[model samples]
Target: MTTTTRTAVVTGAARGIGAGVAKRLAADGFAVAVIDLDEAACKPVAEEIEATGGRALAVGVDVADEQGVQAAVDRIAKELGEPTVLVNNAGIIRDNLMFKMTADDWDAVMNVHLRGSFLMTRAVQGYMTKAGWGRIVSLSSTSALGNRGQANYAAAKAGLQGFTKTLAFELGKFGVTANAIAPGFIETEMTAATAERVGMPFEEFKKAAASQIPVARTGRPADIAHAVSFFVSEGAGFVSGQVLYVAGGPKA
Candidate 1:
C-alpha cells in the first residue's frame, strides 16, 4: 500500500505534544485525524496539515467514553482509509497533594489518561489487526516516576506503562507495536499552567527545570514528536513493549 493510504489518529491534538505528533505524522505522509474534546478545536490542526499539502480530518472525541472512542475510530477507518497508527495522547492533570486532592480530581485524571487510552486502543486495534500492521503510541510522563503534588496525575501516567506493555505482548503477534513515551519537562501550555499554579513566572519555571537537566535545556513538543515518529515508523517494527524516556537526561 502507498504511504498516502495509511491513516494516523492522534487524540488531544488541538495543541501541545498531540499537535506536534499529528503534524509530524501528517508530514510523514499519513492521513491524520486530529482529535480533541471539541471538534472545532481540532480544525486548525487539520487545516494546517492540509495547508502543507497533506490530508487530515478533525474528530472530536472523549477518549474515555467507549462509544465515543468507537465512533471516532470507525469514522477514521471509513474516511481516512483504515487507521493503522494510533496515538493515545489525550491526558489531563489534577495536580494536588494527596491530602488536598478530591476524589473527583483523582477520578478525572484516571478517566482521561488510563481509561481513555484503554478505550481508544481497544477501539482501534481491530483496524490494525485487519491490516496486519500498526503502531500504537501512548503519552506517558516523567511524573510516572512520582512527582510531588501530582498523586492522581502520576498514578494515571504510571498506569499507562503497564497498559502499553500488555498491549505489546498481546498484539505483537498481530503485527502491532505498543509503546509509551515518558517525556520530562516539555515546554507546553500544560507546564506553563503548572508554573502559574505554583505562582512562578513561566520563564523562571522553565529555567529552574532546565538547570536540573543534564542537557541544560528544557524540552519541546517536537522532541516528543520525534520519538513518536520513530515508534510509528516501519523500521520500528521490531521495537515494542518499551517505555522510552524523552527527558533531557536520566531520571533522578
Candidate 2:
C-alpha cells in the first residue's frame, strides 16, 4: 500500500504535540482522524489539514472511556477507511509530590495516559490485524526517567514503554510494529503549564531547560513528530519495541 494513501488515527490531536503529529502524518499522505476529548476542539486542526489538500476527520472521543474509544475507532473506519496507523498521544499531567497527591489526580493521569492507550489500541487492533500491517506509536516522556512533583505522570509515561514493547512482541508476526517516543522538553502547552506551576516565565523556563540539554536547545513538537514518522514508515517494519528519546541528548 502507498504510504500517502493509508489511514491513520491520532488521539489527543486537538493541539500541541498531538496536533503536530497529526499534521505530520497527514503530510506523509495518510487520511487522518483528528481525535480529541472535545470533537469541536479538533476542528481547527482538521480543517487545516483539509485546506492543505489532506483528508481528515475530526472525532470527539475520551480515550479513557472504553465505549467512547470504540465508537471513535468505528467511525474512523467507516468514514476514513481502516486505520493501519495508530498514535496513542492523549495524555494529562497531575503533578504533585507523592505525599500531597490525591487519588483523583493519580487516577486521572493513569486513566488518560495508560488506560486510554490500552483502549484505543484494542479498538484499532482489529483493523490492523485484518490488514496484516500496522504502526503503533505511543507518546512517552522524559519524566518517565524520574521527575520531581510528577509521580503520577512519571508512572503512567513509564508504563507506556512496557506496553509498547509487549505489543511489538505480540504483533510482530503480523507485520505490525509498536514503538514509543519519549520526548524531552518539547515546547507544548503541557510544558507551558509546568512553567506556570513553578512560577517561572515560559521563555525563561525553556531557556533554563535548553542550558541542560546537550544540544543546547529545547525540542519542538515537530521534532517528536519526525521521530514518530520514522517509526511508522513502511521501511521501519523490522524496527519494533524501541523507545527513542527525542530529548536532544542522552538522558542525564
Candidate 3:
C-alpha cells in the first residue's frame, strides 16, 4: 500500500506470521495495532515498529469475545486512528482424526477461527464503511481443502473462505475489499508443535515437507506477509472475494 496515515490492526500479532504482517504494514506507513491475547506479548513487535519511526500500539484482547473485541477496537480508534485495514490472523489447531475429535476441540477451533474473524470484522467494518475505503485479509489454510487429522481446522478455514466472499459481496459497494491468504507448511511454533506431536525433529519435518513442495522448501512468515501486503495495498482495490494460496506452488 502507498504510504498513508491510516491505521491497521493485525490480530494474533505477537509472533510468527502475524508479527511479520504487522511490521510490514508499519513499514508501509500505516499506524499499526499489534493485538494478541496478551498485551505484553505484543510489546516487542509494537516497540520495534516505534523504534523504527512507525506508530504502533500493543493491545490485549480476546478476538472471540464480543464485548472485549468491541472494547479493544474502540481503544484502538481512540489511541491509534480509524482502523481501515485488518488482518484476521489469530487461530489455533486442534488436529485429530474424526473419531478422536472432541466437541471441545471443535468448538475451540471454530470459536477462534470463525467467531473471532466475524467479531473482529464486525467491529472494524463500521470504520471502514464510514471512511468509504478499507481492506480486510483473513488467514485461511490449505487445510481448508481437506487435511488428514485436522477436521476441525479444515472446517474453520473453509468456513472463512465463505465468510470472506460474503464480506466482499456485502461491503463492495462501500469500497471495501475482502480476501484470504491460505498458506501451506509455514515454519512456526505451531508447526514445531505438530512435529513434536508426530515424534519428529522439527528440522526433519520441514525437510520432509519441503521435498513435496514445488519450491523445494517450506514457506515462511515473510511469504505470507508479502501476500497480505498485496491484498491490502492501494493498488489492490479491484481484488476481492478471492483466495490467494501462497503455498510455494499453484496447488497445495
Candidate 4:
C-alpha cells in the first residue's frame, strides 16, 4: 500500500459491529486491518474483504495488553502502511449490579474498554501524527448514560466519551479527528448473549427493545457502520469531538 492509500485498524473486528466497520471501511477504499484477540478468527472477515477486491490484513491482539497492542500496531504499519483510521471497538461486558459485581468483573471490563483504547490510541497516534491525517472512532454505548446491572460497563463507556473529546482537542491541529458512537440495543451476538443472560427469549427481547425505540426496530451492525463510515470520510475533517448516538431515537 502507498502512503496515499488509507489504511484502517479495527479492533474486535472478527465479528459484530467491528466486523461491519472493517467491511465498510474497506468498501470505502481503505486497506483494512481486521484485528481481534484471535488472529485466526479474523481470517474470514479479512478474506471476505479480499474476495470483494479490497485489501485487508488479519491481526491477533489483546487490546488490553500494552505490549501486545504496540506490537500489533507496529506490524500493521509495516505490512499495511501507517494506519490513519482506528476503530477502538474491542470491548467486553461483566454485567452485575454494583453490590454483586466482583472486583475481577469490574477490572476486566475497565481493562478491555478503557485501558485498551488508551493503549491502542497511544500506539497509533505516532502514525497518525506522521501522516498528518487520521480518524479515531471509539465505540461507546447508551449504557454509558447508566444501565441496570452494568455499573462497570457504564463507567467504562462513559470514560470513552471523555477520552474521545480530549483526543480531538489535542490532535485536531494534526488533522486527526476523534469521535465516539454510542449505540443503543444493537442486535448482535453480544445482545443475543445478553438476552440469554437475562433469561428472556431472544425474539422477545428484540420485540421489547423495539417497542421502546422510536424507529420501532432494533439496530443492526450496518447502521452503526454507516455512521462510522461518515466520520472517517475525508470530508468529515471538520467534524470532531462529537458523540453520535446511533440508537433508533433520541437518547436524551
lDDT of model 3 at position 169? 100
Reference-based TM-score of each model: 0.98, 0.98, 0.98, 0.98
111-206 per-residue lDDT for model 4 (tens digits): 999999999999998889998889999999999999999999999999999999999999999999999999999989999999998899999999
Model 2 regions lying over 4 Å from their true place: 1-4
Evaluate model 2: give its TM-score: 0.98
Per-residue lDDT of candidate 3, residues 187-235 (tens digit)? 9999999999999999999999999999999999999999998999889
> Ten residues in a row with the worst lDDT in model 4?
1-10
Q: Which stretches of candidate 1 lie over 4 Å from their true place?
A: 1-4
- Candidate 2 lDDT over 1-252, as tens digits, reads 474488999999999999999999999888999999999999999999999999999999899998888888888999999999999999988888999999999999999999999999999988898889999999999999999999999999999999999999999988899999999999999899989989999999999999999999999989988999999998999999999899989974
User: What residue pairs are clashing in model 3?
Assistant: none
State the displacement of the C-alpha of residue 173, model 2, in Å, after optimal TM-score superposition. Answer: 0.7
Total clashing pairs for each candidate? 0, 1, 0, 0
Candidate 1 CA-lDDT value: 0.93
Per-residue lDDT tens digits of candidate 1, residues 1-252?
Answer: 364579999999999999999999988888999999999999999999999999999999898888988888888888887889999999998888899999999999999998999898888899899989999999999999998999998889989999999999999999999999999999999999999999999999999999999999999999999999999998999999999999999874
RMSD of each: 1.0, 1.1, 1.1, 1.3
- Candidate 3, residue 31: the lDDT equals 97
lDDT of each: 0.93, 0.94, 0.96, 0.95
